[model samples]
Target: MRGIQLSFNKTQKLRLDKALEQLEYFSSKLNSNAIVTVSDTIPVNHEDGVLKGHGTMELEGEVVATLCGVVERVNKLVYVRPFRARYKPEIGDIIVGRVIEVAPKRWRLEINFSQDAVLMLSSMNLPDGIQRRRTAVDELNMRTIFEEYDVICAEVRGFQHDGCLHLQARSQKYGKLERGQLLTISPYLVKRQKQHFHHIDQYGIDLILGCNGFIWVGEHVEVKDDMIEDQTNKSEQQNNKLSGLASHQNQEHNYTPLELRQYICRAANAVRVLSTLGFMITVDKIMDAVEMSTSKNLNIHEMLGAEFYVLVAEREAERRSSSSKKR
Candidate 1:
């Protein structure tokens, strides 16, 4: 017989036998009887009544009596839950991603979960400076740098507030990767690491494993002796031509070697600064930082010429003004 019972509050007390009698009378209309017996305090709500077990009769809140019913078979296996959230990228996580789009300044990478990651122009190392305008030849050679469907190991810089991850590859260990078979895997399974570059010694290949699920593999090989001999012969011939041109320039301008070295050093430093920051490094910004270290009043026009430095200086001034306004 299965029946429902209500337990009295703490201030109320009634004999169990009397309670059972009242329950039977109340449940008779439903064709059930309250079976009275002892039971352990199996936790039941105030609506629950006596089942079969021996337990205490003390009631602090509400007491309820439950009616006994026929026993049914029970299943005992534990259940597992499923994950229900999108993937969140962290620094140094390995991921398998695909190139979705490419622009002159950046590449859009689909990392397989949320929004695509951006690989900025400053994060790459081209033969010329970042500001060097591309020529027709450069456009033809663009694929020599990176092409569509090419996979690379990239580091996650950070994520936008809307959850887009930014990527960078300015180190020698990264950029212009070649000769590697790509691998794909689930982003969640890839473990985050401190460094993105790693050599798979067991496989005899260098792997740039990304936390976004991208992987690049390349084999170690040495240049052949015959190829080195031919390259050396060609380089010597070019060196002779360059020497003749240098002598002509020296006689015409009397340019000091020290001045030339200074210009090269400044340009290299500017490139390094921009690469490290993974953003635009205008000429004025570079000149400002350079001027602070030198006693001489350096002419920006003389250093970088008129056209190039003018554009860079304008950008730098704008950046400074915007920053100052924010502060």
Candidate 2:
């Protein structure tokens, strides 16, 4: 869906436009006058010495927007949240990023931010789950932990004094993602929440809703319960490894089932449709779209059809309309 141009027939185009209009109407009712465009001066108490946030800059002694977006002010801090743009990181946000450059003492990731984010080796635990100070040998073996192009999950550790965004992955759940599909959507669609990691029990899959645009749909991985292994368990595990090393390796390489793979693609397609329709993507709505396809017995390939797109747009319009009335 990223580069594909979808063509809609006349009837489909009109229907889609109407549905989008309704959706826009409902959204505009919430903040119709707050929208501003490039170089537009933000309405603020100029005497208060307002601190400008992202998407804004102080030009000629006036706080003017640098992009087209909605204006927000918190106390004396004012910023513009752009409609369609790269992710703006906040501290403690769970994110999925791809390793771009394994730099010295740090692994730089492309988190869809204005600049790439860095995850320092000193900031993360070793593979053995130790928190000791990183040694020279550890720096030499950084690639062994995370090579270029590896998709990983981590949390925001906030910006540094030098203005670099740092990330941390001290938890077992945060590590290299394997045997999964990565999908990118609008970052604003994903609001920060308490839980971004979701396990779909029915499909035996894991869905990570990154605060950034990247999403991961993969086979469910049972999180390792213990970070520090006791001597007894280590001994048992070593004995077990000695008993059947090949078998253990085979188990580790177990392939995903065909049925599960199909479901993953189906779920990914649901996300694609939602993104294309400009709808706010959430786990519940994604599951609903998947369930709709399942109930209708539609094939995975058919989920991207023009008809399905129209249906999703219509469904969202009707849903928003109903919720508005209930309020």
Candidate 3:
């Protein structure tokens, strides 16, 4: 019942009746039913007896039907049917993501997909009671508002012609996340769900469930408290340690939060052992370049549901820039 047959001419239409005749030569037709499907697009109507492209015909008990039209040609597997479900991100879809890199115009987000999506600076809403075009200063300060490792809620702005998705958070509910652990899941699963982003109101945990197989979660109270404590500690530690070092150590290290996250991801994955632990491990050590390299290796791109290479070209560029400035 399962076999492959080819059509020789592009102008011919492999009608149901003609297909049955060809099939009859291979198998008996007595007490058998047949169904047909065109594996490729045929001329609107061709009278030639020759079959064109590929097609499938099925015969079951007493039922006979043709599932026709253009077919996907990969191997030879043909379906005499259509898939009932398809995956596509829609507007207002709530997704969770990790900041992968920040360029001048936008932030590249690794939404756990083959292509990292983009969130443009224009898509972000101004803080409450402050309305003005985002200036260079605002762009530079962007990281101060949303740093690397910060989880955020956002809406799907739409997809680019090349299939890259764009996200925007213009409302109070869509910006600067306070708490939650991000969970990555398949984009297909997110598309199938009635609600893409789920607020864990019951558990009182904020979460951004990205369609790209990335999710962010944090404990509400702890995130805020820790952020403040971490900032103070970082300043104190930097001052105490740098006092003993040369003034050259005071060079500014500027990067968007997303860029930092990308660096951390790369560094965490570079470690031989941690590379196998997967992408969820957080790398907090800021001073060790070797650790950062190991982490970066683990930040693989999830394209077509498979793990692919991570986007580290930007990280390399940053490193070169930093080195040049130091010299």
lDDT of 3 by residue, 1-327 (tens): 111132324322323234334434333322122223433322222233322232444333222223432233333333333322233566767766667676776777766555667888888865421335888987897786566665666778998786778999765556665423344433433333555434433333333445554545443322223243335554565674466244334523432355444433333223212122121222221123333444544332221111211222223334445655676
Error of 2 at 33 (Å): 4.1
Cα RMSD for candidates in order: 29.0, 3.6, 20.1
Question: Alpha-carbon error at 2 in model 2, in Å?
Answer: 9.7
Per-candidate local distance difference test: 0.46, 0.87, 0.44
Candidates 1 and 2 compared: the better one by lDDT is 2
Predicted candidate 1 versus true structure: per-residue lDDT over 164-188, tens digit per residue: 6888764444554444455443343
Q: Using lDDT, rank the candidates from best to worst.
A: 2, 1, 3
Which 10-residue window of candidate 2 scores lowest in summed lDDT?
225-234
Q: What TM value does model 1 have? A: 0.37
- Evaluated at residue 138, the lDDT of candidate 2 is 99
Order of candidate numbers by TM-score, starting with the best: 2, 3, 1
Per-residue lDDT value at 231 in model 1: 54
Best by TM-score: 2
For 1-327, candidate 2 gives per-residue lDDT tens digits of: 343367889998899889989988998886776788998988788888789998899888788999899998899999998887668788999999999998889999999889889999988867665446899999999988899999999999999997899999988889899888999988988878899999999988899999998999998988865533434466666665475567757878888899999989999999989887767778989998999889989999999998788888888889989999999
